[model samples]
Target: MPDALADALYELIVATRILANEKVLDAFGHVSVRHPLDPQRYFIPRHRAPELAEISDLVELTLDSEPVRPTDFRLYSEKVIHGEIYKARPDVHAVCHHHAHAVLPYAISGQEIVPVFHLGAVMGKVQFWDQRDEFGDTNMLVVKPEEGASLARALGPHWTVLMRRHGATVAGTSLRELTFRTVFTCDNARLQSQAMAHGRVDALSPGEVKLTAAHQLRPPSTNRAWDYWVRQVEKAGLMPARAAAKGASTTAARAKKADAKRAPTKSARKNSVKSKRRR
Candidate 1:
C-alpha cells in the first residue's frame, strides 16, 4: 500500500479502537475516512465489531455506498450513513456513527445535546432527525440511499446530528477531529444529564461556544488528545500492529489484564447478593 493510504488506514484503526475503549462505540457503530486521493470514494470496515477492526478489514465504497470492487465481505447495513454525509458535505473528511449510552438518553428523549463544557463546544450545533419524519419507520436503519440523503439534509452544515431513538452521527474535517468530537460530545451528554438532575443546565453561550471551540479544536489540542488515546489503546492491547510495536509495553498490557481479573468491587458483590436474594 502507498504511504498515504497506509497511514490513513492505521490512524483509522486507532480511531476505531480509541472510540471503543472510551465507550463511545460498542459492537454496532462504525467510523470512516474519505479516500486520500479520491473524493469519490471512502473507506469503512467490513461488518464486524468496531473494537476488532484492522487494516485488512477495510472496504472502499463510493459516495453512494457501493463497493468499489466486488467482495464477499459483509458491509455495515448503515454504511450509507457515511457515504451520504460525505456526498452532502465536501468539508467533512471523516464520519462516525455511534449509539453511546451517554447520548442515547438525549436521543430517545428528544432533548438537544448542547455544549455543557469547553471541550464539547466543538459540537457547534446539533441537529435531530427522526426516521419517522420521512421514511415513516421501517426497520430504523439508514440502508437506503434516500433515507441517508434525508439524514444528510438534516445534518446540514452541522458537526453532529442525533437519530431519534437510534444514535448520533458526527462529521469532522479529519479523523482525529472526528474522534475528538464524537468522544467529547458523548461526554457532554453525560455531563448534561448530571447537571439536569441538579435542576438546570448552564450550557455555553453562543459567543462562548464559538470562541472556545475555535481555541480547543485546533491541531495542537486534537493531536495531544489523539496521542493520549493512542497510548490508552496501546495499553489495552488494541493498537494497530504497525503503531503498536513502537510504544506498546507488554508489561503494561499484562498489568491491565491482571487488573481486569481482580475480584469484584464491594458494590458489585452487594448487587450480586441482592439479586440472589430476590431470586
Candidate 2:
C-alpha cells in the first residue's frame, strides 16, 4: 500500500502480539489506527487470536460503522464502539480496546482509571460516566450511540476511557503512542489494583498530573525504535503458527534466532532468574 498507515497498523499489531505472548492481552482485545488515506475510514483487525494477527488481517470500516468487507473477510462487532468514537471526536486517530485482567474489576465497578502509577499520574483526573443502564449488549456493552457519546464525554480531553463492565479504550495521535499508552494503562491498573488492597491509593494532584502529561513525549524516533524492535521480536521464534504464516525470510529469521540465543530469555544472571520487562 502507498499509505504508511498499514505499516503503522501492522507495527501496533506486532506490538499487540508481543503483549499477548507476554500474557497481557488474552484473545479478546483489539487495537486500531486511522487509515492514512481515508480519515473517515479506520482499520481494525478481526477479533482473532491476538498472537496470530498480521497486517493482512486488518479490515477497513466507514465512519458510520459499516465494515467494508474485503473478499472473505469478517468484521469485529466492537466496531460499533470504535466507529462512533471516530465520528464523534476528530482529534483521536488510534483507539485500543482490551480486557486486561487488572482493569476489568474496576471497569465492572464503574470506577475511574485513577492516577496510581506514574503513567496514571500523567493521565489527568479521569471521569466515570454514569450510563450503564443505557447499555444492554452484555458481550460488547458499548453499542448505543448515546452511550458512546456518554463515554466520550467522560473521556473529555483525557486519552483513556474505562468502559464500564467491558474494557478500557485508549486514543492517541499515532499507533506507537497508542500502543505504549495501552501497555502503561494496564500496568497502572495492575499496580493500582494491587495497592488498593492495602487502603485508599494516593493519586497525583491535578496540577502534578497535568505537568506530567504535558512533559510525557516519546519522540518519533522512540516510537520508530519500539515498532522496529517489536516487529523483530514478532518475526522471531515467538509463536510457531504465526511465524509459519507471515514471518521474515529464512536468513533474517536465522539471524534473529542466533541473536536471541546469544541474549538471555529469563535473565543475564543465571542464578537470579529475573524476567525482563517488555517495553
Candidate 3:
C-alpha cells in the first residue's frame, strides 16, 4: 500500500487498540478515519471487539454512512454518529464514540464535562446532547441522520460532546489527536468526579485551556502519547500478530543500537586509556 494509505490504516488500527487498551473502548465503542484518498469516504471496522480489529475488518462507507461495497459483515447501528459529524464538520478527519463509564454520571445529569488538566484541555467547554429533548426518547441511539445532525450542532467547534444517557463523541483533525483527546477526556472525567467530592473542582479556565491545548496538539506531544499507548497494547498482546511482531522487532532494534552505543569499542578504549593517563 502507499505511504499515505498505509499510515491512515495504521493509525486507525492503532487508535482502536489504544482506546481499547486505555479502557475508553471495549466491545461497544467505535472509531473511524476519513478516507485518505477520498474525503467523501471513511473507514471503520464492522461490528467487532475493538481490540481484536484487524485491517481486513475495515469497511469503507460514504459520508451518509452507506457501505461503498456490499459486505456480509454487520455494520454498527450507530455509524450515523460518525457520518453526520463528518458531514457537518469538514475540518474533522477522525471521530470516536465511547460509552465510557467515567463520563456517564455527567452525561446522565447534563453536567458539563470540563478540562481538569492540561492533557484533557481539548475538552475546553464540552456541549451536552439530549435525545429526549429532540426526539422524545426512543432507544437513545444515533441511528438516523437527523439525530446525528442534531448532536453535531450541539458539538459546534468543540472537540467533544456528551450524549445524555448514552456516551460521548470526540472529533479531531487527525487520528492521533482524536485518540489523545478521547483517552484524556475519560481520564479528566475520572479526576473531575473525584475532586468534586471535596465540594468543588477547579477546572481549567478557558484561557488556560486554550494555551495548554495548543501545546498538547504539537506533533511531539501527540507522538509521545501514541507511542506509549501503542507499546502498552502491543506488550499486553492485545494487538494483531503483524503489529505485535513489528513492534517487537522495532523495540529489539532500538535496544541493540543503544547497547552498541553504550559498549566501549577498541577506538573508545584507546581514547579512554589516554584520558586515564592524563588524569
TM-score of each: 0.86, 0.73, 0.85
Q: Rate the local accuracy (lDDT) of all candidates.
A: 0.83, 0.62, 0.80
Off by over 4 Å in 3: 243-279
Candidate 2's C-alpha runs over 4 A off are 1-3, 129-131, 136-140, 144-150, 220-236, 239-279
The candidate scoring highest on lDDT is 1
The TM-score ranking, best first, is: 1, 3, 2
**TM-score comparison, 1 vs 2, better candidate:** 1
Candidate 3 CA-lDDT value: 0.80
Deviation (Å) of 123 in candidate 2: 3.5
Q: Any residue pairs clashing in model 1, and if so which?
A: none
lDDT tens string, model 2, 101-206? 8778878886666777556653445455545465543445565556666677777877777766667777777766666666666778888888888889897777
Candidate 3 C-alpha lDDT tens digits along 1-279 = 335655677678889989998999977889999977568778888788887777767776677777655456777878888989999999999999999999999999888777887887976578889988889957777887798899999999878999988899999999999988888889999998888887778878888988999999989999998899989987988766676445434533443454357433333333331111000
Best candidate, TM-score: 1
Off by over 4 Å in 1: 243-279
Error of 3 at 17 (Å): 0.6
Instruction: Look at candidate 3 and give me any clashing residue pairs.
Output: none
Candidate 1 vs candidate 3: the lDDT winner is: 1
